[model samples]
Target: MENIVIIGNGIAGVSAARHIRKLSDKRIIIISAETDYFFSRTALMYVYMGHMKFEHIQPYENWFWEKNRIDLVRGYVTQVNHTEKKLLVDNSRTVAYDKLIIATGSKPNKFGWPGQDLHGVQGLYSKQDLDLLEVHAPNKEVCKRAVIVGGGLIGIELAEMLRSRDIPVTFLVREKSFWDGVLPQGESQMINEHILEHHIDLKLETNLVEIIADENGRAKAVTTDKGETIACNLVGLTAGVSPNIDFLKDSGIALGRGVKVNRFLETNIEDIYAIGDCAEQHEAIGSRRPIEAVWYTGRMMGETVAQTICGNKLEYKPGHWFNSAKFLDIEYQTYGWVFTARSKKESEAHFHWRHPQEKVCVTIAYHNETRQFLGINTFGIRMRHEIFDRWLTESRSVDHVMEFLKDANFDPEFYENYEKDIISKFNSDMGTTLAVKNKSWKRIFKTA
Candidate 1:
């Protein structure tokens, strides 16, 4: 049996272990600094709102590993010796492996400004961070206000959680709008409006100068770049995170913004693999550059590594990037060249606009040259938006979808034809299966 060791018990590590176990009777050992089994890191925000218990957010029970006969070692990984294939745990102990997997994840990026280490300043990352917030969980009498220092996904989620608990929240954004890097200026404005309408104060184009700590060593206020100061009890920083690569400094492995890997998910060192937040992956569309830090990407990489180890003939080829999130009763999404839509070519550059209400709007765009559905943004839509599924498979020119909408009529047959072409294209290109279930095409199709 092969001796295999995996560091970190996150989604990537767990998925790798599960998939690899099915391929061979390897002596698989998983080492985790934390004790919890696989759990939904994405669901941490719900815990703050008291909508879910910690137990409810857990993805798997203890029995999951016992059934697989995989060895679980609970210890902090302090160091790594790639040449010797050994890992140091808890200062004195070491474990050797024939194959090593590093899925250690990432640590929250500190603002690097002065007074960041103050008692009342926090970064929302792990369950530990959530636990700390729970201890100081907002109350009108105790903790009335909080300053969320970033306006991205985690920051937005935390703002909602704080509001649900009746805690007044203010968001400080470095860009001109919320999610500036993720969405277009117009889409960002729409979200910013919705955020403001919900009673959340937003400070745009602002930078954090320093956190002001009170005499008791707790954050009492925060100073911004514009020389404005706001009194607050808690300060949450969701700036971003860096890969957990301190242990690998002496390991002779290559490094980039994250651990470097090729199409096979194998690192520079022999018999060693990296995945999840710690490992960067090739993007599905356009440049195919490495993308770090997303739950779905981590899970996909984990499975791909396992298949490679199992001698399965498969190569990981990411396609049709999908991005979606729901916030404050509004669904928002952006995918593909939504970021790259500034090029010259108005007609060739696909962009459509729709305003459902005064404060609600929809924007969809595509890269006609690539026949790639670029992105869609919808605000205040009553129904769920699953345009991502269509965007993933559809090859229709963005103009077609736009033209269909201009007729002010619902032609299920046209949509059905478009969907069929997309399914066929995906199947031919990626060897993906796309069978309609239970003859369900009738439901979405218009019979002539």
Candidate 2:
């Protein structure tokens, strides 16, 4: 039997293992220092907010692994001796394999601010980080205040997590407006208002100068770029994350911002592959980034690589960019390409719509000349992925999309239908008399 070893049993590694098992009977061993079993990484915040338990994040029962003939090892991988096809785990134990897969994910980025290594200063990424959060900020009394650095999605999430426990939070954003680089002016402004409404002290155009450490080496406060100090017990470093590929430094594997991989996710060495957040595409795939940190893309890469290992070689092709996230009470979804002013093409234009009082809005991007629909960003609304995906593939026009807007709505019955309002706004902007049409259930449900 061929011994297949996979390091870092995240969604990518487990996905490849599961698919590979279905295709061939190979000895599969998944090693990770994080946990004994695979768990949902996205649900870590929910676990902290009392919505779920640590064990509940795990999707599979303990018996499932044994039944599937997949072996799990609990140890930190210290080194990868690729020449010998062996891994140094815990700096002592050695494991050998015929084929190896590296699915190690990402680690939070810290830029060496003073007192960043203090007890109360940390980043939320792994289960260990979640555990640390519980110790540092269990409640309002324990952690009086938390100062979050960076203006990205992770920063917002940390603010929400701290607020759930009645802990006051002061958010420090270097950007003039929160996520302005990615979002439009309207959406970013709306988010700024929504955040303030939640009672978070959002400080824009502010930078963390230093984190003041207490006598116990815990973070007590942080000084800003303007030389203003704010007292806080916890400091969350939500700057960003980079690929976790430190162990492979001496392994002769080519490295960019992440592990360099070809279309098939193969690394520089033979019989070795890398996937998930740690794998960087040799070339950009369409509008997608080389190293994607998103969960769905990681899952897709795993399934694609599994085929090659099982004698059915397949290329990793993640079509049509789509993602969903929650910004406090509002749910946001985006499909296809929605570029900001910096990245937008000269021929591209956008039509935006928002409710008078509610936090409901949508931005549609299209070709200015051709009127072909390019992408859309919807907030406080549910949309059908299949509908938009099919429209993109068909190269449907913006006018056509507006006429059939109701079909794209996921919950036309329960959710407040905004089709008429959206159509009216679009017509007002485009100067075209387009009427809203009833949803075609057949068209919405049809699969390619």
Candidate 3:
């Protein structure tokens, strides 16, 4: 049989392994330093919030890997020797392979701030982070306050987790509005207000200066660029993550900010491929960034690479960007390319609608001249992903999308109906009369 070695036990690496086994009985060995088995990274927050246990996040039982003839190794890959077709495990052990797949994933970014390496200061990414949180901030008595340094998705997740335990969180966002870079101004401001409502000390436009350490070498507080020091037991650096490619620095693989790969996810070296968060496309696909750290994209790249490795030669075509995330109590979903107001193209125009008292809102982007539907962002409203995906593929007009909006919603029985109110507002603003049509399954789930 042929030997196939994969680095990292993330979703991307494991998905590739499972699919490859279905195609061939090749020798597959997956190595990871993070955990013994793959667990859903997104559910890390839930685990911290006590909603689920760590083992519960795992998709398969413990015996699944052994039963499938997949070998698992627990070791940190310190170096990769591509020419020798071997990997340096834990600086001493060497593992050889016929074909290599690099899915090393991402690491939390650190900008070399003072006292960053101190105890009680860490980033929430891996299982180790969760374990450290248990040691450092198990309860409000042990951790009175947590100062999170970034306003991204991870930061919000940490805030919610800590707040669940009655531990106050002080969030620092460099942006004027929370997640304004991705969300439109309307939605961003709504989230800012929502954060405040949660009793979180949301400090907008604030930057972390340094983490103050106690006499015992643990984080005591953090000073900001504003020269103010707020006392806290934990400092969470949730600024963002970067490619965990530090091990490949001297490995001779082509690298930009991440491992450079072609459309097929093939790196510069033959018989070696890269995928998931660490794989940076040579040329960006559509409006997506060269490196997408989203979970679904990673799984897509994994399946795509497995096909090529199995002689099917498939290209990774992640059609129509879509993602969903939760902001405290609100649920947010975005499909296609709904750029922020500042980032909107010259031809783009947005139609925004907000419920009077509730946090529900939706923004529809369309071409100003053509009225062709561009994209949509929904908050506190559940919209069917497949419905928007089909509409984007069909190149439906904005008017058509509005008329059939009822069909696109995921829940029609209980959720508040806003199609009539939204259409009325759109007509008043755009001076065009358009009424919503009754939802039909044929239109929502149309095959064509």
Candidate 4:
């Protein structure tokens, strides 16, 4: 029996292990210092907001691992000896393996600011971070105020978590607008206003200079780049994250911004592979980044890598970009290529429509010359992912997509349809009266 060792218990590692077990009878061992079992990392915010407990985030029951014959080790990996095919654990134990998988995922980025190592100063990434938050900011009385240092998704999530407990939050975003670098101007402005409406002290164009520490080495306040000092009990450093591959520094594995791997997720060394956020491709895949920290991509990578380990080599090809996120209470989803103001290099045209009374809007991007559909970003509305994905794959024209926009909607039957309004706005903007066409259910459901 071949012993397969995986270095992380995240979704990538667990997915690989499960798929490998189904294909082969190999013995698998997953090791992690973060937690004993795999749990949903994205659900950490919900846990803090009292929506669900820690155990609820775990998809599998405790007995599932034992029944599947997968071994779980709760220890830190200090080093990996590629030549000997062994891992050195913190307890000085040596674990030998025939094949090794590195899916260590990401860690919070720190820029070596002054007093950033204080007790109350932390980043929200791991379960340990949540535990520390529970200790530092148990309630509104305990945590008088929290100053967040970044304007990214994690920063806003931490702000929402703090707000759920009636704790005051001061958000410091270096960007002039909230996430403008990634979102369109209209959407970014709307989100900025929405965040402000939530009573958060959103300080735009601000940067953190240093974290002030009290006598006991706890964070007391934060100093900004403008020389303004804001007193606070906790400081959140949600700047960003980097691949967690420090243990592989001396392990003879090639690394770029992350562990360098081919499309097959294979490392330079034979019998060793990497997946998830820790795996960096030689080039970007379509519009997807080289290092995608998204959960579904990680899961897909795991499934792809498992086939190769089981004797059926497969390449990782994640087609058609799709992602969903929430800004405060509003739900946002985007499929295909919706470029930001900074990244809009091509000759494209945008048609944007928003509800007069609600925070709902949709922006469609398409090539100006060819009229080929590029992407769509919808907020406060539900759209079928498979429909847009198929349309993008087929290279549907903007006019064709708009003519049948009502078919892609995933809202309830009683919910109002905005297809007519969206079509009207598009026609009014483009100076073309393209009437909506009715199609049978078979035609609408047909694959492109």
Candidate 5:
């Protein structure tokens, strides 16, 4: 049996290990820098907001490792010696491997604004960062202000969490809209309205020149480029993250946008593969650039890399990239390509479904030309989560969806046929069930 070594024990690393176990009874070892139990980092915001307990974030029980017969090493990886096929650990120990996988992910990027190293300035990237924020959490009654410096999903989520604690949150973004790089203008404005209504202040088209610190090194205020200063006791930076590839740089492994891998996710070096946030994936759409690092994308790449190493020739082709985020009691989702250029001339159909009782709105986006569905964004509704998933996986045209929408009700046979068509196209499963006792689902439509 070959010895397979994987660095980083996050979601991507653990997902790869699970798949590789099914393929081979090999000696698989996972090297994790964090010594704690495997927990969902994405859900930490919920924990911070008191929506869920910290224990609820654990992804697996302690016996999971024993059941899987996997070895876990708690240490930071310092370097990868490609020639020797060994990984250098922080404590100077080296472990050899027949195959190596780098799923180390990325780190928070603080773009060198002055006084960034101040005591109260924080970034929410890992569990450690969450702990740091918890430690520096301001006294609600004494200091009620917090300035969050980013408008991305993570930044916005942090803003909501801060608001839940009754601390007034000010979101300062250099971009003119929320998630401007990913979301369209209309979608951004819709979510922005909901956020503002929830008592959060948004300062768009703004730049943070420097973080002003108090005598004790705590962040006291932020100076803006537009000749303004906002007084806040705490500052949270969510600028962005970059691929963590410092150790692999001189290892002769290819690096373009990230660790360059083919469709099989194999690195330039033999028996070496990269996945998760660190890997530069092949874009199934127009450009082959590294796509945004979403959890599902990382999971897909992890499984694909494992299969390839197990001698399976399966290729990974992502149909569409999607990310879902919720803020101030409203849920928002986005998928596929948000039109960037007018010359692209892509047609999109949108529909807003509102529930007056719940005061919620569900927006759907469809590609008009291909008649194929693209994405959906539902706010203040939970039942429509599956609707968004169907839209993303089915790859249906707008006309097909519009036709189904006209009927509104789907028959049993039609639902099965729709599910079959969707599974065939996306090569993934989206299970749907009917509420009636012993009754089957009549139809499942993909809405974009």
Candidate 6:
């Protein structure tokens, strides 16, 4: 039997192992130094916020791996020798493999800032980071103030986690508006207001110059580009993450920003493939970034690579784009193409609607010339992914989408519907009064 070894027991590596096990009886082993068992990385914030325990984030029971004939190794792979088909574990042990998969995932980015390696300065990416957070910022007394230096998803998550324990958080965002690089002006402005509403010191257009350390070598304060210094005990460097492939620097594998892989997830070295956050496609795929750190894309790459490893080669094809995240009190969801102001190259028209008394709004993007629906961004509202996916696939027009918007709504029946109001606004803005067709009770109540 061929021996298969997968490094990094994240969603990608675990998914590949499980799929391969279903297809073949090959000996499979997953190696990781992060944790003994694979846990949901996204749910780490919930664990800190008292919403869930550490064990609750794990997808499978403790004995699931042993019962399923999948072996687990708790070690770190320091280097890979492609010619020998062996991996050096902790520079001591050698693990040979008939085939190998590299899914080491991502690590928090550090830009060589002064005092960046301080004890209380950390990034929220791995289990070890969470453990460090517990030590440094267990409560308000321990953590006087937390200064998060970014406005991305992870940055906000860290701010929320600290705030959950009544810890003061001073959020520093480089962008003029909150997440303006990704979200539209209206949506981004709404989030900016919402963040301030939560009593967070939301600092916009602020850049961290350096972190000042205390006598104990922990974070003491942060100096900004504007020469402003904020005193804080915890400094969260949640700027972004890069592919965790530092160990592979001398491993003879081709690497760009991440490990270079073909569409089939095969690397330059034969029989040794890469996937997930560590795998970068030789060419960009549509609008997808070269390094997509999203969890679902990692799982997709895992499943795709497994087929090829199982003698059923298949190209990785991550279909339509869709993602959701929470911003303070608002829940946001977006599907298809919804570029920010900076990236709005093509001529597009936007129809935006905001509720009078609620932090709810939806923005519809459409082609200015063709009037074809491009995408929709909804905040404080739940929309079915499948519905937008189908609409985007069918190339539905903006008018058609608005007219039948109620049909795609996934909110509870008792929840107030905003379709009529949205349609009225759209018609009023476009100088036309288009009536929406009445839907049967069955269609209206149908699940997405």
lDDT per residue (tens digit) for residues 76-150 in model 5: 888888888988898589999999988888887788899999988888878888888776774576456889998
Q: Taking the tens digit of each residue's C-alpha lDDT, what string does model 6 give over 240-341?
A: 899999999998999999999988899999998999999898977887778888899999998988899999999999978888899866898988888887
**What CA RMSD would you report for each candidate?**
7.0, 1.3, 1.1, 1.5, 7.1, 1.9
Better by TM-score, candidate 6 or 3: 3
Steric collisions counted per model: 0, 0, 0, 0, 10, 0
Would you give me the overall lDDT of model 1?
0.73
Candidate 1 local lDDT, 1-448, one digit each (tens): 7788999988899888998998888888999876657678888888888788878987777787888888999888888887788889988899999889899898878858898898878888888888778665557566768999987888888888888888899899998778877666677777888899999999999999999988999888999999999988889988877898877876788887788877788888888889888986533335445755878778887888888877784566656565567767776554544552344245444343435355545556665456455555555432222334453455655544443332211234433434344344445643556543323323333531
Model 1 worst lDDT window (10 residues): 402-411
| Candidate 3 stretches greater than 4 Å from native | none
Off by over 4 Å in 1: 281-285, 340-350, 356-360, 368-372, 380-394, 403-448
**Cα lDDT of model 4 by residue, 1-448, tens digit:** 9999999999999999999999999999999999999999999999999999999999999999999999999999999999999999995899999999999999988998999999999999999999999999999999999999988899999999999999999999999999988889999889999999999999999999999888998999999988899999999999989999988898899999899999899999999999998999986676678898889999999999999999999989999988899999999999988888788866878888987778889999999999999999999988889889888988999988887776787763412466667778889999889886555324667653
Q: Which structure is stronger by lDDT: 3 or 5?
A: 3
Question: Which segments of candidate 4 are over 4 A away from where they belong?
Answer: 412-417, 436-442, 446-448
State TM-scores per candidate: 0.84, 0.98, 0.98, 0.97, 0.83, 0.96
Best by lDDT: 3
lDDT per residue, candidate 3, 327-425, as tens digits? Answer: 999999999888887898999999999999989999999999999999999998898888898889989999888877877878865343777788899
Question: Could you arrange the candidates by TM-score from highest to lowest?
Answer: 3, 2, 4, 6, 1, 5
Of 1 and 5, which scores higher on TM-score?
1
Query: 139, model 6: CA deviation in Å?
Result: 0.6
Candidate 2's C-alpha lDDT? 0.91
Order the candidates by lDDT, highest first. 3, 2, 4, 6, 1, 5
lDDT of 4 at 48: 91
Pitting candidate 1 against candidate 3, the one with the higher lDDT is 3
lDDT of 5 at 20: 93
